[model samples]
Each structure stands twice: as C-alpha cells, then as structure tokens.
Target chain A: MNATEPKPTEEILESLADAKSVFIVGCSGCPVGCDVGGEKWVDEMTAAVRGAGKDVTGSALIELLCNKALVGIKLGRIVEQVTAAEAVLVGSCGVGVQAVGNMVARRTVPALNTICLGDYQGLWPGEERCGECGECVLAYTGGLCPITLCAKSLVNGQCGGTGDNGECEVSPDHPCGWKKIYDRLKELGRIDDMRRMIDPRDARKRAIPDAIRRTTRYALEVSEQEDPAPASEE
Target chain B: MSKLQQQLEAGKFVVTGEIGPPKGTNIEPVLHEAEEYLKDNVAAVNVTDIQTAVMRLGSMALCHMLIDRGIEPVFQMVCRDRNRLALQSDLLSAAALGIENVLALTGDHVVMGDHVQATPVFDLDSVGLLAAISNLEAGTDMGLDIKGNPNKLDGVPKFFKGCCTTPCSPTPEAQMIKLEKKVASGAQFVQTQAVYDPGAFENFMKMIEHIKVPVLVGIVLLKSAGMGKYMNRSVPGVQVPDQIIQRLTDAPKEDRAKVSVEIAAEIIRQVRPICQGAHLMTLGWDHCVPGIIKQANLT
Candidate 1:
C-alpha cells in the first residue's frame, strides 16, 4: 500500500451525508495493533461522522477480515442494521474493505486510508507501516527488511550517499540498510560476505502485480469448509 | 507562587495544567514540557499515571522529577494500576519527597491501552484510594496496625488530596452522588473533565453549590471538529456542544488553531467566575497555552 494514497474519504462523506443510521466495522487484525483500522479508529471515525451531523446506529469490531466463516456469521447481523441505514463505514485494512464490499450489497463506504503494514512507530499519529517492494529480504539483511529501510531500496551494495556517521542521506536518523547489513555481518565475524560483489536481485520476485491474492491459511480454511456438516455437528 | 500558597491567598485565579507521561523511558521531553509550564507560572502541574489506560513512566517517579525541577507536582494516583500496598508506598514516598498534591482517579480500563490482555489491578476505586491516603496521613496503614505505635505518621508530610468530577454528565444526579462520595472520602479539591459549554458548567455549579471543596474547571484545547467529537464519544466525561463543533467546522484549516485557542479562552472566561481555577488540558498543544492565557486575560 502506498503511504500517500487517500482511502475512502469521499466514499464515507457521500454515503453518510443524508443517512439516518450507520454502523462502523473495525478490523481486529493489522489495524488493531497499529491503532488505525481497529476499534480505536472506528471510535474516532464514528465520533467524526457524528460530529459531521450523522446518526450512527452503533459500531462493532471483527476479529479478522479474511475469516469468511466469522464474517458470514457476523456480517448478517451487521447487514441487518445496514439494511435500515443509508450506509456502513468500514475502518479496516484493504482486505476488510473488500470483504464488506462483497457482503454488503452495494451501499457501504470505507473511511480509512489503507496505508501500509508496519507496526505503529508514532512518527505519524495514525499511519500504517508500508513495505512497498513485494520482497522479503530479511534473511539476507539480518532481520532488518531493507525494502522498507533503504530510500532507494538498493538490494546489492551500500549507496555512496551513506553518511560517514552511518545514517542515511535521505533521513539522517534512519540507518542505511546496507550499513546495517555490513555491521551485522561484521558482528557475526562474516565481513567477507560484504567484500564479494553480489549479482543483481531477481526483479520479477519484487514486481507487485495489480491484484494480490489471499492464498494463505485463511483462504485454505474457507475452501475446506465448503460443506457445513462439521460445523452443524459442533 | 507556590500552589498551596496561591490556594490559601487567592486574588487572581490560579492556573493548573496536566502532563501525560510518554509511553516509554524517554522522559526528558516530558520533563522539559513540565519545566515550561512551571516557567509560565502555573500554580501546579499534574502528572498523570497511566492516563487513558496507556502505560508510561509511573507518576510517582515523574512527580519526583517535577519536584526536583522545583515545580510543585500534583501527583495523579489512579486505582486501576496498583493495589493498596503499592498505593500506600507511593503515597508515603510522595509525602517524603515533599510532593503533597495528589489527584485520585479511577483509571481507564486496560482494554483501552496498548496491552489489552494486561491484568487490571483495581483493588480500590478512587474514593477508597483517597481514604487510604487519609489513613496514611493519620499514621496508620490499611491494616490499622501502626508502624511504631498508634498515630505515628503525624509528623510525615501531609497531602493535598484532589478528585475528579464530570460536570457535563447526562445525569446530574448520578454525577452528584459520585462527587459526594469523593468529598466524603477526604478530597479537598475537584478537577472536572473538559467543559465545552459554560451553561452546563453553570448548571453543574448550581447543583453542587453545597460542596465545600474548591472546583477547578477543565479547559481542553480543541484541535479539530473531529477531535472534539472523538472525545465526546470515546472519552466518558467530555461533551462538546454542537455549536462548538460547527464553529470548528466553519473555521478554515489555517485558522482552526486560532479558533481552538479562542474557544478555550472563552470557556475559561465564562467559567472562571464560578470555579476556583481553570485546569488547561492542552492535549499536546503546549505552545498554545500561553496564547490561551493571554487571550483569556488570565495573566
């Protein structure tokens, strides 16, 4: 997610402009810990909507957006409320926005800007961590993901712009990812790793296509539970 | 002027402020802010303990830090974090260190903070904590066994205990009951939650005219219409009127800060005559406080 991309602000304003009732849905996953898409964001958003002259019916927080089973059970109750209202505002990650979009016929709007997927660093009071490149190079970088660190996202060698004091030229406080890598290797008694010139990274692995997929454990669980017999037994 | 001395000899209104400790060991900035308020001639500075359920450097340590800087700190001791023993120890330490002022509060729930699963320790509510402080002042712990003999702590430093009240509660009767309990539990002063509408504060003052303790009106600087509404919804005691929200909305983005200072100054102007003093909750808008004071003609 791009940090600057504004989320569904216009959608929220239009949907709730004349609405008599609204229900805010918050995600309990990524945004919860980051203090953005979770219940706190919902609370702040709900208050902002009410402040803007709208009647909020009530709000609820869901555990995970990708959990279709939980969403199926929970969305029905929320949809019942939304049916009476003009719109439903979602304060969740991009996944939550899509889930609610799919579940709630065509009415609900999203309030939050789905920024990124990093922990709350407090630089911006309520912004997400965005690791742009779709590559996980933590193993080679000594657990510090360089994709988010290096200003240029250089995977091979240290940039000439690295300051003598070991801070990045772009942001002095932020350490150069390559410098960090060099220091970590030196501490591990493996300085030779930096002396050898490494080849360029495979660009295809880092190329993020337009659409992402949820082919992980959450999607697998949903597909395996197509038959609801076991749920009935439980 | 010393806070107690100002309270004793009052002509001009007294000004008090709150400092929310940062959520880490990095307290230099927090201390710098406290020193700034102290330099501004504020009667007292309140150091909050785990405010809004967020953990920070404990109030006891921060209070000592303020005292070390020659600022009189009103140490805030919430019942949500510590039990009776820890509470008593902290109180004794406060008294020993000459940090006399104390504000007793029933802290926010643990779920509201960063660590949700952290167990809450609400062994005693605010009133009980006040009663415990009174007991400690009387030289007896909660167990009623005197350390050396009966009434031994008479020579220890005394605490100026305070409590909080929500002036804009939907139900005044319920609020009055809580206020009465606080007064009965040995609270000498009452600091209220944010008061946006002066009319509500006037009505509340009329309702509690019989209360003998000094009432300090809380004045929070409005950052935005969104912030005001958020506090009204999420924070338990605060209620910002629709007109204030509209004023903030109508204000241009560049002039919103000016409008906020103006609104806070107006609130203080309207309520100063009815209360003992005004406690400004800058909400991290520390730089605006001196401006608010000047605009309100409080200096």
Candidate 2:
C-alpha cells in the first residue's frame, strides 16, 4: 500500500489562496491505505475548503491516479468543473500528483508527499521494503535486497564493519545484511555466490519520461494489412 | 584504549598489537599470540572482528577468552555489520565479561574476502560507531532511553574507545576530516592504517597537529617485495613507496626477512618521534616483530 498523510491545513489553504474554485484529486490505491488522501479525506478537505472560503468545484477518487490514460478518461467526464477551476489540488503521492497534472493543462499542486510502496499482509507492511530502483538484485541475495538492506548500498563490496555475532555494526536494531546472505548461501550450499560482484545500477534505466509501448493485437493487425517497405525506399 | 589510553594520557609512547582469530574453533592461535607477545611490550592486544570481512570466531568471544587467559584484549568493533542494538548489547557484554578496551572501525567491505555475496550493513561509519559507544556509556541506548527501559536498574558500562584512520590516504586532507570527527565523537586515541611512507605520515601529522589524541602509527612487517607491491595495489589507502619495493626486490631470497625487519625498524625509527606509538600488526609473522623492535631500539 502506498502511504500518505494530509498536509497541514494552513499550508493547503495557502497554496489554494489565489484560487476561488479548485478541483481535488485522491488515489483509491495507496493514499486510501494511509487514510491521508482517500474519499473521506477528500470529503473532510472539501469541508475544510468550504470553511476556508474556496469553492470545491469537483473532487475525484481515482481508481489509480497514477494511470494517465484512465485519468484522461475520468477527467473528460467532468470538463466543465475542471475548466471553471483556477487550479487543481492533488491529495495523493508524488506520482499521483504528477499524473493528474499531465492530464490537465491547469496548475497542479501536491497536498501529500509520496511515501513508499508497502506490503498489505502486515509483514513489514507499511514500511518501505524496496526502493524500487530500476535494477533488482534480490535473486542472488536470497530474496533480501542488498540495495535496500545494506546501509551503505554498496554494490560491489562490504565495508569490513560487521561484528562476529551476525549483527550490524551500525544500527543495533538491524542484523548484518551480509551475514544474512552468507548464512543463506551457506545453507543453500552455494557459498560461491558471495563472490559475484553485482554491477553498478544503471542510472539511465531509472530516468523519467521513459516509456515502453508493448506490442498489441491492433498494431499486429495493422502491420498485417500494411505493405512492406517500398523497393525503392529500401 | 583503556590501558593504552592511560599510558597515552601520561605522555608515554604506548604500543598495541592485533590478532586475527582462527576460522574454526581452534583457540590456540589467539591465546598463543597473546601469551607470546602481549606479555611484555605491547600495552593491549586487539582481537579483530573478522578482519578483511572473512568469516572467523567472534571478537567478543575471543576477548572473553583473552580475559580468561589473563590478557588485555581490545575488543575491536566494526560498523560494517552490526547495527546499534547489537553494538550496544556487545558493549554491555564486553564490560560484563571484563573486556575494557574497544577499537572502532568502518570495516573493509565484504566483497574483499571469501564471502563476496554477503550483504554488508555499514549502518554507521567509524565516527558513528564511536558515537554509539559514547551513547551507551552515557547510561542510555542509541535512542537516548535508559539502558534498561521500564525495568530494574543495572550499572552503566564504560569504555575507552579508539578509532582508526588512514593518514597516508590518496587525499590526506579528507582523512583529517575523519580524524577530527572521530576525535570529536569521543575517540580517546587514534590508530592508523599500515604506514610505510614516513614523509607522508609526517605531513599527515602536521596537518592534524591539534587533534590532541595519541596517534598510534600502523607498522606492518613486509616480508617481501611481492607483499609490498601487493599491498600498494590491493589495500585501500596504503601506498608502499617504490624505493621500499626496490629495496625488498634487491635483497637475496634468504635475506628477505632481514631486509623486511630492517625496513620496519627503520620506518619505526623515522616515525617514532612524530607519532605517540606504533601499533604493530603481525599478519602471522609474529616471530619477526622482535627483530623489528630490537633493531628500532623499542626493546
């Protein structure tokens, strides 16, 4: 679950100060789990906005505010309110806030800071377990992410700070991440896996505005009907 | 730094030694080194915590053994693995087990040794580890709560903590920042990485003249030119000069040990006045240290 908390009432009002009318957007996914930006929070925000003297032209509890295509469709259903509003206030995480903004031409301001992806089954559920870096190294680490587990996030080697008790030399609360790997690999009888030096994370893969347009049946059908490259052009 | 600290505080040049514990349950190597060398000149012997990030016996357990054998074991704690919970408890455990001196280090990375796939936890660096020791000593945990929260009281554990630095770093200025930070974080004294170049060390000493802590210069006994060249290439921040490597290469195979001892003694004699003392790391050549000490007149 994505977690979020409501921004301070005063700060929200200050951001919405210049607008007489505004649109509120919340996520049904992550923000709802944290109770920071779901339907009730949107209702409470509407009341807070009414009290603060701004008109709530419209509000949306998007199924996934991060889905730009769905957002565009939902946004099309209420074009009038959106046109009437001077600005939009997003009550979800950073991704949600940006998603709504991408679908709208008007100014979009975030009302909630993007926390982290969380598990639903309550196994370290609400905390950020994975940083979701573009590359993943959990397979070699016995399902433990060295990038997220280790404190330094060193990709190649461990700093020799580990104590002998399989305890971390840094924080006393966490176990030595490498020791866990060692024991796991030892048990699996694959202690040689520890010698594999994971390559540095490729930054370009994580770069934003990147896209992957998967092959679809429609494209396949269109390609079937289309002629091959012209002989002269080829 | 407990015994060594007192000695340093008294303006006396104090020496300390280090021992790497055996991989399996063999206790003889550890005790033999302590009984052999630490009985006389060395103020304290540091029980390494998996030196080079390789698997080994626990430093705390070895410290307890050293204590049982009537030796002063400096319980070296590295931040590379343990978090505060383990570190704090180990501090209490060490004190309870009659272990006093503690050395803080940001251990070598796990990839350097036999275990390459190990997940390292360098939650705290060297300075952070030293600060953790201080936090534990102040009758509180890392979160600043009383040692035993919501329970009966126990005596506070006190430690004479020390930290390591690389004075001959490629960038000595940055090393000074760490040195000063370690001192600021309550490091009683400072031990350095292996020092082969005295000019660089004197330059380092000149830069950090105001730290006010005793600096125990690191002196490793180089057995051959191959060892010197390998150290210069493999070890982090340790640069063995070309002249020293050439000297080692020129020595006959039979005279290699003699040349190594002579070089170690000469380096000690050169750096002795500048540093508070030398922390000799034998690296399994404990027998050769006597020659180095004798030649340098440290006996």
Candidate 3:
C-alpha cells in the first residue's frame, strides 16, 4: 500500500485561503490504511474545511485515485459541483493528486504528502520494496532494502549512531534497518553479503528522479536537445 | 602525511581533540582555546561540520584557520549539508588549503539540531563519502567524463581518510560490518562515537581485529552528573555507568571538572592497551585535554 501523511493544518488552510469553495477527492487505496486519504478521512477533511467556513461543493472517494481513468469517470459523476468549486483538495498520494490536477482546470491543492518507499508497492501489503537505486544488491542484502529502512538511507551498512536497543539513531522506537538486514542475512547463511562494500549510490543511476519527472519528460528532453548559445557578431 | 597519520603509522598512541566551530563570526575564542589548549597536546584537532547538524561556520574555514595558527585540523565533513557535487568540490578545496586529515560521517539528522525544519541532504552516506575521497585521490571524481569514463581531476589530493563507529551498539555485527566497509572504502583510520564502557570497548576492539586501521576510542568529557544522566536517557549507544555519575554528583561543585578529567583519564588508561589512541572530545572544556593527557601519562 502507498504511505501518505496529511499536510500540516496551517499549510492546508493557507493553500485554500483564496478559494471559497473546495471539492475533496479521496483515495480509497493506500490512504485508507494511513487514515489520511480514505473515505472516512475525506469526510473528516470536509468538516474541517467547512469548519474553516469554506463552502465544500462536493466530495468523492475514488477506489484508486491514482488511476486517471477512474478519477475522470468519478469526477464526471459530479461534474457541475467539481466545476463550481474554486479549488480541489486532494487527499491522496502525489500520483493521485497529480491525476486530479491533470483532469481539473481549477487549482488543485494536495492535502497529503506522499511517503516514498525504496520499493514501489504492488498489490501485496508487505512493507519492503526496491528503492530504485540503479544497483540492486537485494540478493546480497537478504532482500532487505537498506535505502528504505535506514533513516540515513545508508546502503553500505548501518551508521555508528544505532541505538542501544538495535533501534535507529534518528528514531529510537524503530528497529535499525541494517540490523534487520544483518539478521535476515544471518538466518539465510548469507552473512557474507554484508561484508562487501556497497559503492556510493550514484544519483545519476537512481530511478526516482526519472520516475517523478516522467510527466514532464518531453519538455525535459526538448530542453536537453536545445542549446542556449546566442548568435552574436564577433 | 598528516601528523595524526604519521603518529598512527609510527605506532604512537596518538591523541586527537575535537572542536566545534561557532554559529557566527565570533570564532576567535574557540580557536584560541584550540591553539592554547589543544594544539600541542593532541596530534590533530577535529573541526566539526555543522556539528550535531546545528548551522555554524563551515568546518573547512575553521580548519584552515587552525592551519594558519600552526595547528593541524582533522576536517570533519558530514554528508548532512552538501550534495555529492558540493561534497567533492569541498574535498578538493580542503586539499588545496593543505588540510590533510578528513573524517567522513553520516552526520546527525537535522531533527537533532537547532534547525529542525532544515532539509538534510544525505546525498552520500559516510561510506560513499569515503569512497568519493578515495576516488578524488585516484584523480577521478564521482562523475563520469560524459563518455561513461571517470572524470579526471585537475590535481590529485591526498588525505589521511578516517571513519567513525559506535562501539557499543546493540547490533554490534551491523556496526562491525559497516566498519569493514569503511575500511574497504579506504578508511585509513577510525574514530568511534563516545564510549564510556572500557569492557565493552575491549570486546569491540577484539571484534574488529581484522580491520588493520588504527582506532581512536572516543571519550566525550562529561561536564556534569546531569549531563551524564542526560546522555544515558537520550544519547544512543552511550551509557555512563552509575558509579561515574555518582562520582560527578558527589564531587564538590568546584571539583566537577577535575572529576570529569579523572574519569576520562581513567577510561583512557583502561582502553589504551587495546586501542591505538584516545580521541578526547572535550566538548567546550578544551582546557581539560591537557589535564587528561597528563593524568593518563600520554604526554
């Protein structure tokens, strides 16, 4: 499932300050589990938006907000109310919010901040996944993603600040990600995988940047092809 | 080679000191303390970069100033503030300025610092940073030559590369594994997180027997009993035993500094036989380094 958290109340209110009417779009997928972008969450957000004295034109909880076709058909059901609203407040992952923004002509504000995972989630509910780093050392790491688990996103190994209880130094309550990798590798009799030094993650090799910018890929590709040298008389 | 590296190579029980650059331009007092108290006693003084993630005068400038004052500085570069390009450029700058020792760290998360709202740039973890240093030393940057070849550097810079470890981590194997990676990535030396337990340190040293780099045990001077208790409660992988805290608590208010020095010196004595050196992190008490050195008979 996708992980999402609500934007701060002040930030959400400030972004919607100029709009008198707001239409809410909630994702029934991952956000439901997070309790921030589901049907219940949309209802709470509607009241909260109404509490701020803005007129909420309508609210719709789409089964998968990230699915652009579903969002298009769903918005079609409430076309007049969606058009009447000055802005659409999306309670979904960044992908879903972008989907809503693409379909609507009005201002689309995000109510939630999408949590990036190392591994892109599929239909299964497991927490771990590939971080999209160019190099896949999962076989060596016992299938644990250090990039996703470690607060520092250290791929080589654990940092020196691991807590006394095998928790992360940044968040003591969470178990150290590298420790989990070590335990899993040990159980599999592949502890030697932890021995080799994982080279510095080449950001050039990382897939996240390209994945995020795919929507604007054509514009980026055109800009890369065009040189900005001015024709001048010497 | 840096004096610290030379001493470590010569099998000398080298002692290093740490100093944090101030938040503003009024850096003379801290520099003066280092020059006066730390310059001669320690092999090299580490200038912390935005230490504890608090924004401050950059470590490179302070390190250069230390050089101006005839004191060698271990330029501590944390991967918390700069991206890879900036980090690589700074490494070249440190080398150009004649700063020899470089300690790479992942750095404390920004949440621990004064600028909690600041975005942390972990573009490179410590292992990656250490590798970057190694790459720069090999006359290539972390980037390519556009034709998929390693980019050549204008001039190669040599540094006594160092990495840090937490000796008493709950997951010792994880720490050890990272230490091995750091060494493999060209960490010529290691300085650990503040370790109070001599017994635990001995065990850690034994565990890392395969890593040939000289290790300097970290000893952050406990300023007071309250500080020790605070560390025990809040600081990770750092446990200050009760007897030491009790000693600090019982020491008459005037003798607290002396007790702290004595305690530090005692720990140094305990760990000296197993480790190569002691890294005295006096925090703000620079004057205590000389006293600890004298008490530990490392003068």
By TM-score, the best candidate is 3
DockQ of each: 0.01, 0.06, 0.46
Candidate 1 - CAPRI tier?
A: incorrect
lDDT (10s digit) by residue, model 2, range B1-299: 46777888888777778788999999897688678866576888888998888989899998898778777788998866787668878888899998888998877777666787887766566666777777777766655236546322268888888888777665454456556767777898888888898998999999999888889999988888999988765565677899999999999999988998899889999999998988888787777767777898887
lDDT of 3 by residue, B1-299 (tens): 88998899999999999999998999999989998999889999999999878889989999999999999999999998999999999999999999999999999988888998888789888988998999999999988777999999888999999999989877777788888888888999999999889999999999999889999999999999999999887788898999999999999999999999999999999999999999999999999999999999997
| Model 1: residue B289 alpha-carbon error in angstroms | 1.1
Clashes of 2: 30
Q: Which stretches in model 1 have alpha-carbon errors above 4 Å?
A: A1-234, B8-11, B146-155
- Model no. 3, DockQ: 0.46
TM-score of chain B of each: 0.93, 0.94, 0.99
For each candidate in the order shown, give its overall lDDT on alpha carbons.
0.66, 0.70, 0.82
Residue B36 local lDDT, model 2:
81
What lDDT does candidate 2 reach at residue B245?
A: 96
For each candidate, report what fraction of the true interface contacts it reproduces. 0.00, 0.06, 0.76
> What stretches of model 3 exceed 4 Å from their correct place?
A1-120, A204-234
lDDT of 1 by residue, B216-263 (tens): 888988999999888765564467899999999999999999999999
What does each candidate score in C-alpha RMSD? 22.4, 15.1, 15.8
Best by DockQ: 3
For model 1, the DockQ equals 0.01
Residue A182, candidate 2: how far off, in angstroms?
Answer: 32
Q: Rank the candidates by DockQ, best first.
A: 3, 2, 1
